[model samples]
Target chain A: MESMEADILIVGGGAAGFACALEAAERGATVLVLEKQPETGGSSAMSGGCLAFAGTEMQREQGIEDSAELLANDLKQLGGTDADPALIAAFATHQLETYDWLKAHGQVFSPALEASSGQSVPRVHTVDPADMVRLLAARCRTTGKVTLLVETAARRLQHDPAAHRVTGVLAEGRDGPIDIRARNGVVLASGGFSRNPDLVRQFAPDCEHAVFVGGAGNVGDGLRMAWALGADLRDMAQIKGTFGKHPTDELNNHSCLCVYKGAIAVNQDGRRFVDESLSYKLLGAACLRQPYGAAFQILDEPILRSGDNEVRILDFERRLEEGLFIQADTLEGLARQIEVPEEMLTKTVADYNAYVDSGEDREFGRKHLVHNHGALRRIETAPFYAYPSTAAVYGTYCGLRVDPAMHVIDVFGERIEGLLAAGEVVGGFHGNAYMTGSALGKALVFGRIAARTALGAAAG
Target chain B: MQVVVLLAGVVDPKWRLDRLGLRPGTELADESGLPRRLSPFDEAALETALKLRDADPAVRVTAVLPGDVGSDALLRGVAAFRPDRAFRFDTSGLAPWDPRAAVRLLGLAVGAACGCPDLVLMGREFGDCDDGVLPAALAEAQGWRFCGLAHAVAIADGRFVAHRIRGPREELLRLPPPALVSITNDRGNRLRHPLMKNVMLAKRGPVEVVTPQAGAIPRAVVARSLAVVPPPQRGAGACRILSGPVDAQVAELAAYLRARRQAAAP
Candidate 1:
């Protein structure tokens, strides 16, 4: 029954929420960010730290030609038809500016470029997501205008029907239930619903079997609140997963996808399945269809040597040390460790080796390591390794529908007046497929837009 | 009963070590950039504190973290566990081997927070080898009873009943109060998942930080430097390719592994 007030109230303190807080603070607005978790960073901290940007200096230095147009096209192609063209266009145009803003705000990006799941070029600019968030949170606190109330979870929005506005939000904190009035509007950047089992079973039942490795606090609180207000939804059926997660990995939630480093993925039958060059999401889809929904990334010593132990997708040796990898002197021995039929696995490796030698993959035609990059290598080393890989639902790609301006839109295509949203909670940004950096990118790009649009309207 | 809990987080063991580097002229490890988490042993000790608090409502627990601002995130994460009070005993300028100065600072911090705790709980190893010696030495310095390898500790008749696993047998030592016990990681003492509410509220809470004297202090030991090397590679060599039929290849690999194991046996 306590109360507080701010011009703009932000729900969730992940990348998107923090970005909004920083933006609103820059505009001289008194903003309050309510984070559900004790710590600020949500899934953003656990993310791969790659942001999708176009025409950056990093890209230029790497001699990789890229444009917003090409980037948007790739997003559209990957996201499928369900993706909102306007939102994709918005991400394309403003991504470079957001990148600059982040850098200008003490966020450091390593110049090294990496090619992730769906990136055409090495456009995935890397930043330590946790560090970036910590820096942002520190900056917000120092500003004095932005009050980040951690452990404060918003329960419901206060929508004034008479004024046709969202006045504030009611949240639970240390004291008890407290109401916070937002003079401008309320922005929901609370992220996705990947961690909610009931919600996952309802929306993405097919992928429910996959491990839930999302941020512990991401339970679709934003989606539920939006639904209560009649907000329309999009791409709900597009709840898929990323493929490198090890099912047995409890200590570390990372997956070493040696497959991208030219390892072949095999099913329980010990036969190669899909073309390993496809997007991990697509690979995950193929994996779910296999018997017992089991798959493994089988590799050899040469491929293992090529693994850059630092990178999750390439850390073959680390996984080997963790005993997550089964190394044997022969293919049959490797197969026995992973519990697959020895004979079938041996034949599969032999065929794959032949394919690599001839540079011709008759089954999957996977000539490249990942997405038209890197040459294929034969897995014929003395100690063959098999890393058990399972697809896990990381982030829910579908949720409340929103316009390019970051305003939550209802079923009738009308903006839920006074209700603005950002981050993974607002959908229609990603279509059917996900680009490597777009999830976090969308959160940043849209979070800023939401704040600017709300503040601009207030000034008007 | 008042309890002082000492907590220190280690760099996530699961993370690649390439991020660890020398801090140029400084003897300190460049830990500013890596992700840190509550070490298993730290969790065990914290769980011990919580269990003590839960068992007796009169028990008050305070957490003391010793580090620089680099540990703020970890400090906030620790706060979510709802410790009554948490203090960061700044160890920024102190040398690694200066247990004399370090213990003095810790004793001062503990006194400043809550005078003379009934129990002082900490992990057996304080992250690094040299620093791990502090807990045992601190117990002697404070003139408190010291116990080690207490996987679980419980209050029985106002005394500490510690479960220490010795070989295959379990020893139940009933130690008097005002003891310093170094907890080892045990499944029974895994820290429970803190509620999201407490997790949020802890960040806004104040962390009492105490700075040691700014003047350059003499140390019992001076570090020449530190070498951040990858752990020695295990079973390094070329893979021996066994060709021919599947059965022949399997038999050959099995025999090779057996022969290698026998040859290396002491």
Candidate 2:
């Protein structure tokens, strides 16, 4: 067995871990990062790299009039009543700083703000998550204060009982069991537990059997670690669902684009379920309401063409050619091919067309003012296309409860001294729904807070 | 001379822990629970096998996979590559098996069923475990010559010659009769993207099942467990893009590298 020591021991080298390591090391603390995979970049590396922030310097430069208060209010409203005001406030306040930090860290953001499904303002900034992770890893390597141990799995937390602090971690590496002692604090940036069916079943029952598209490394390690340390949990039932097909099979572009962009979602029975114009989190939950939590997004060629290349027709065409996308020229033909009810599908399409022509979505009250093809398209065009869609659950928006400073709390609402958390490990920031870019954004913000707090503790 | 190439399916090392431990689902969809494509290394092995089959019509390419019933789709996927015959070895219960145990079992089964192929082609290492020891173990078990990190291979004059990349050196070797060769990723032969027509045809191909002798192989030695901790996320300093002439950019890059190296030195 081998033993190592550091002033700050950050577990899980995904976006949060890397962010914390960089900040803590820059602040002059010796940082040790334990990564389970041969390479760094967990789920964050696999993401679309869309950072949704308001009042960013980039946004200001673009002359977009936005404020942190507005951003906070919008996030709270989008997330609904279950969202934590304090955490959301902290996130909004530090939103610009997070972007600045990323820019300072070698990440280049796109100038234009892309529209996400439910976001009110155009604030989605896209970058390559893999590139960001790579840049962070390279920078960490440059910092002499940081040491990265790859192919090492942190299994448990060793807490100081008298002091009620996380003192060290137990890990299994290629060499065997290794103990890593953090003189100050241990930050759990390991991602969510979507891959763990048992954990998903226990917490997010709605998406228990739903397929996942996020990082496989996110198996609820952070949540479990927090639980072991007696941290109180909240929003344990919240899970974010994505729209996709059986992940092992080829990806279907048409279905994903149509469903994500407000195309009518129908079951095999050929009936429209939920309002296509709802938020993605709600859409995912709605998709789960269908038969076996499986449905298809029905769209016409016009809508497909009008949608973004990445999210709409191009994705569908690619998937169709790859045998992942299922398509047909006629409504009846498609229904028969996918085993849906022809008459029901025809009626659904006809009714949808009626709604499109009138510019009034009576059933779902979908606003017709937006002109983007997928979400607000008129389904009057012929040669309709449909792709099988299902619930692809990512991380659960549930875990240990934390304060504004991101300190883990006990069941009695007492702060767990010397114990801090960030990223998906600490929930309640997101209630029933998550804000776009909030997961990665929160991971960056709280990870820094955790590091600074740990450094302060170490110095004391 | 007949040649047989063994195409083994390897999972992405990125999701190995989730696959073997917490996520008990056999489907790749179950691990990351996302749609997964074929492993690059396995695809390379398949490409090599197809090339060999094309070169020598008599040479039979057989894909031996140790998986369960859910692997039916995966087998169908491999068939898309146009192998002459596909064999699915039901070793699901023996999963998370150590490299040594898997190699020994595969050797015995190949010897009994396929009658010791003239040449066995395998990837240098599966992406998941990255043990990089399967070729040697299989070679030892079958009592055959072993060549590793093979980049190029060809059959000639009743023998097989292979080119291996050993660091900066390219070494060539010839093996007579029976031998095992491990293919490297950077090998000159590139894996071709499967055409849709081929994939459709593969879905309809017949896949034979070979059951290993009851308890004939030893259990795997290594035990894998999950690491509950997530990976670290360190941020990099912003990019300092230098504008001007190409020479100026190069100068800046050189200076940055030099400074980085100095900082890295203890």
Candidate 3:
């Protein structure tokens, strides 16, 4: 029956948790990060490493002009009216400053600006998420005020019903059970419930069939704990998977996103299905509704070569090296190699190529390569390639609801006292549709805000 | 009974090998930036020791890490498993390639951590570079009975019993205390996730870091070498699959290989 106390107890040592700990410790608060996994870095480490930030230095250097207003408009348009306008506005306002904040705290980003699933312009800045988490965790350790506890999972939030406050936590450790008193407040940055099949089945049943690709530690512990406190949840039914995950290749975390770079998606009947130009999250939903929930990314040689080998989802050449791509001299041969009907695939490609030549996607009307940019190309080449692709639940993208100040809101429409949240565990930022890189972005922006609020600082 | 497990392993082997780089001016690998985690066998040995601790009320599991001392992030990283006592026998921040050198250093480290431990457990290969060298060399140096490739180790009749896979069958052997056993990963002996509460508490105090005096180097007969192996060139040609039954496909594959081998028998 060991017990300890800290000024702040941050559950889940993920991108959000680590960022919160660093911010709180810098402000001279004793912060403790409890992670259930053997190591930290949650799903953030396994992500595609893209962060959506408007008006970034990388964007300007790359000669692409972007603004917060435009970025906010894209998110709202893509996410529909379901997304919290207040939260999206807050994110737009702080997105640029957060990018600078991360850089000021030893975070580095690649200069290359690449287009991802949903973006009007190239703004997805990349980083080695694992290295970034390691760097942040290293900084947290150096603070002498932050204690990181991996292999320690928070079981439940200790709520003082009379005081209407979450005072502490009941957690299980390496040895046995222990209680921790969060003197100031407890922050839940425990990530999403994508890894928990039961929770996924309960909330977003459509995602149940998607390959569960998420942080092993994310099993809805924070979600359940918050639910026990009557915390209102948001966007639960909107959990959509990331498209183009190699149906059988579970080892690699990143999915192949050739569809975003002018590749077409074909269903089991060797016919094109949904418009692949939409957000990948939307594509995942459309893909699942197809036959057997499986499809293939059919592209030309130029499109195959357009892949950036460094980034995971963008690295089509790596997948080619790994033998994930079925290459053939003719589309018929590729269709046969992938065990699909040759005639149907050949005709499908011919019609698509004709449409590409005519400058219009007649049937699906896929105008842009991704979202609304990058012109589509004709799939006419000697050596055609086809990759069997499906969808995977990368992150739940839904969880407890929180306010702009990062306070967890209850079902009664009141803020839960001494309870704050950040990361994938606190959702509603991405409503019905998810734009790539925004999950990590939201985690960072809200993580700092949560720390500032918990430390009694004015919400910046 | 005090049991000591070697809690060291190779860098996560799952990393894309294309990312690996070799240091210039030295044959050493540039794995300092790589993510290092407990190997499967390392977890197995640690799990086996925990099982022993559970089976016997008096048994205590201690960990002896014979690698980096400066890597407090990694050092305290493994200590979260909540061993009874754990410490590092500081090396040059890397495990030496010499088998005998690793043995001498590990022997001193074991002695320093737990005086005359009843059993010493280690992975089948320490960092893959050791290749069962550490356990064999240590047992030889200490003159203790050695057992290698044991998937499961248990205490029975006051003796250490090990069930090992030999060829296609399982073999069991029993040895007296003060035994050194090299363990391989087993389905049942996976390391359990440590509770979050204990992980925080276990790493509170400073990890006992000791720098053992360098042992005498043996007469050198071994010189290690390193080379990058290029992948075999795969012919970029049409792959034709024999559309038939399984037996027919196997026969065709066998005939093709036989014909190719005979044609190349120059």
Q: Show the colliding residue pairs in model 3.
A: A151-B196, A152-B196, A153-B196, A173-B195, A173-B196, A173-B197, A173-B198, A174-B195
lDDT of 3 by residue, B68-162 (tens): 63445556756876678777777753346667666777788888877788899999888756766778888889988999999999998889999
lDDT of 1 by residue, A1-460 (tens): 9999999999999999988898999889999999878777899989877788989988898898999998998888888789899999989989999998988887877666766677777777877888888888778878899987877899998888776578899999977999999999999999898888889999887895587887888999988987888899999988887787776457667656688778999987899899998778888878877765658888888888877644555656776665567678888877765668999999999998899999999998887887766788888778888777778777888898988888889888888887899988988888787887898898899989999988988998
Give candidate 2's error at residue B140 in angstroms: 39
Candidate 2 lDDT, A1-460, residue by residue in tens: 7999998888888888888898889998899898887677887877656676888777778776667877687677767777788988888887788888888877887556645555566566767677887788778878888988877889988887887777788988889999988887788888888778788877777775467766778788878877877789887766768654532353331125455454678876788887765556776788777765667778777765654444232245555445444456788877765667899888888887788778787776666321121336565565777666666765676788988877788887887776678887878887866555677777788888788878887677
User: How high is the lDDT of residue A76 in model 1?
Assistant: 81
Q: Write the per-residue lDDT of candidate 1 for residues B1-266, one digit (tens) a residue.
A: 88888887788777776745446677667766777887888888998998888678788999888778777778888887777877787777554556776666667666766777888999988666445777888788899888888898888898888889999999988879788899998877877555323544676777678775665345566666566566665686755566753435768989989999999999
Candidate 2 fraction of reference contacts recovered: 0.00
> What's the interface RMS deviation of candidate 1?
20.1
Highest lDDT scorer: 3
Model 3 lDDT at residue B200: 43
**Candidate 3 CAPRI level:** incorrect
Which regions of candidate 3 deviate over 4 angstroms? A457-460, B1-266
Which CAPRI quality tier does the interface of model 1 achieve? incorrect
Worst 10 residues of 3 chain A by lDDT: A451-460
Per-residue lDDT of A411-439 in model 3, one digit per residue for the tens? Answer: 99898899999999987889889887899
Interface RMSD of 2: 11.2
Candidate 1 CA-lDDT value: 0.81
Best by DockQ: 2
Assess every candidate by TM-score: 0.64, 0.64, 0.64
